[model samples]
Target: MAQDNSKSELKLTKYNNILHTKIYRIEINDYQIVELIALKNGEYDGYLINCIWKINKNQNRTKSITQKIKIQNLTVKKLMAELENGKFETIPDCQDLKGCIEGLDGTTISFYVYKENISRNYSYWEPESDYYYKDKIIPEILQIREILKSINHEFDLRTSFAEFRDNLPKGKYTYGMVIIEKK
Candidate 1:
């Protein structure tokens, strides 16, 4: 009988053991704002700001309201698969990642990965041009963006700094990914 080597030839990573994940969108105008949170368990929650009243012809008041939605199991599974295929487990430790480029601003994307006692947070600015950004980060980000698009949960990439500055009280916008160990 021939000895089987197929199992040994395959390389498995920690992502295989992932039970849950969460993605957060952090935006900063004058302060920090967590605009959205998406979990691997299909729970998606966030806050949306809407104009509540007009203070003047050129001014308006806005209110932040909480919103909750769920991703279909199939879409969640697809997202997980995309992450796995993106080699998320192979990503270097946060400390080892090359610092992001300056002047790259928009929404701050953050990924929180959790397994048991081990939790890691990977945050990045949009349109990073660093070496690691081109080689590793971009691929993962692209995967995430594709998944989000497929699920109709696309990130707000149209917001500009001027808009953020003009509507400081309305809060900034951002989006990203997270993974956590399932209970």
Candidate 2:
């Protein structure tokens, strides 16, 4: 009988834990730049900004990812602030948080948190919308997914290191994947 080589244990490093993942220090200034680019040419006009951020493996890596999110008829500032402050732990209903604002740094802002009971009437533009995960979260997952995929490896998206921040209706700092996995 052949031995169960697949069951053999591989050496794990201390950095494998979530606590070991690296976090970069970013400020409002860093976000101002991205907000400018995303808004240039009126690319995201009607869509209200939602979340922005990134993920990482540990503190030793350099380079990280950035994200920008916008949703139709959704709260801009409150949603952005909630996500920034780690509110909801997961994405909340579009109607649950509602308010209105002029803009952030010249960008228009609005509010529209969802009501869980109301239920959406339209089909999802993106299949993943069913999940609480945000678009900003997807790309970061893809970065790791692509890397692991290329190497014929598999990883758990849930376990992946991710961090995000946003400035709704305009300006936001939605990246920082540096420190989890390296390029």
Candidate 3:
């Protein structure tokens, strides 16, 4: 069955060492790769994100694995490099975050989050338009748009305004979303 086929293709290994590593087997189509990453915060002991990434590709099979990490212990220039490298996203614009990025050899990495949009013809209601969503939504929309542009314009930034907006809080300005433009 399709479900069993999917299940058989997935494998995960847990390493509870002091270094905090977990390995995963990922299969898509006929390709498969094994990967791992470090966990931080109070999150999952050692797993950083819900998804694992291939850090390096070796012989089309093995790769150094990685996961999204907060821009906690890196630097601004470093963070930009990581963004270019697709390691982290949305570097916060605050003193702590600035310090976090600045702490790592002047090179900090950050992680970004994105979601797909599903609203019907929501583009028509975009801030630039007068479609009448609300006066307040415009600020949020502009904020999100600026973030999207910063991420997409340089440093190999990946993600879009539509994807960002769809993930915003339905009716309020949640501090959770931020635009991390490389300075």
Candidate 4:
């Protein structure tokens, strides 16, 4: 069953209000990255990087797109102000991932947020593992992912992730996603 998230969405501060994020993900055949950054002056920058190495590593195809998008939305603005005003405190670090405990080899997801001076990441071993679905999913993390995904809708940043998740071969597969924070 899909977990209830409405109440969790109301409390972004409960987890943390983030502005910049760097999501690095790995799967059996590909590696992808999503970066989102926002500065104190209200400037926003984003990038989507995808690398799919076929069965033959030498035949790898990589695509990287960079954009300094102009976003105009009140909900986005309010979310930003919440960061600056402290209604949402910045989550300087990643949460401890507790969902990857089955076969020793499975998919792993590591989400992170970094600053000029430091970086932190949250990791989940494999969404297909025994303990995978049991983890206390963070509604805030999911919210941030959606926000970033929406901002980069033109790039079609999410379809591939969903595809990969849906096509996982059993060994230990998981969904892939990322939300970047920028200060």
Model 4 residue 113 CA deviation in Å: 1.6
Question: Model 1 over residues 12-123: C-alpha lDDT tens digits?
Answer: 1223224334433222221223333344565544432211121332333222222223334454455545555655434443335455333334444444454455556554
Rank candidates, lDDT, best first: 1, 4, 3, 2
lDDT of 4 by residue, 100-142 (tens): 2433344444444445444555443443332444546554445
RMSD of each: 16.0, 21.1, 18.7, 13.2
All candidates: TM-score: 0.40, 0.16, 0.19, 0.39
Model 3 misplaced stretches (Cα beyond 4 Å):
1-137, 155-183
List where candidate 2 sits over 4 angstroms from the true fold.
1-64, 77-178
Clashes of 3: 12
Sorting all predicted structures by TM-score, with the top scorer first, yields 1, 4, 3, 2
Stretches off by above 4 angstroms in model 1 are 1-63, 93-95, 102-104, 128-183
In terms of TM-score, how similar is model 2 to the real structure? 0.16
Best prediction by TM-score? 1
- lDDT of model number 1: 0.36
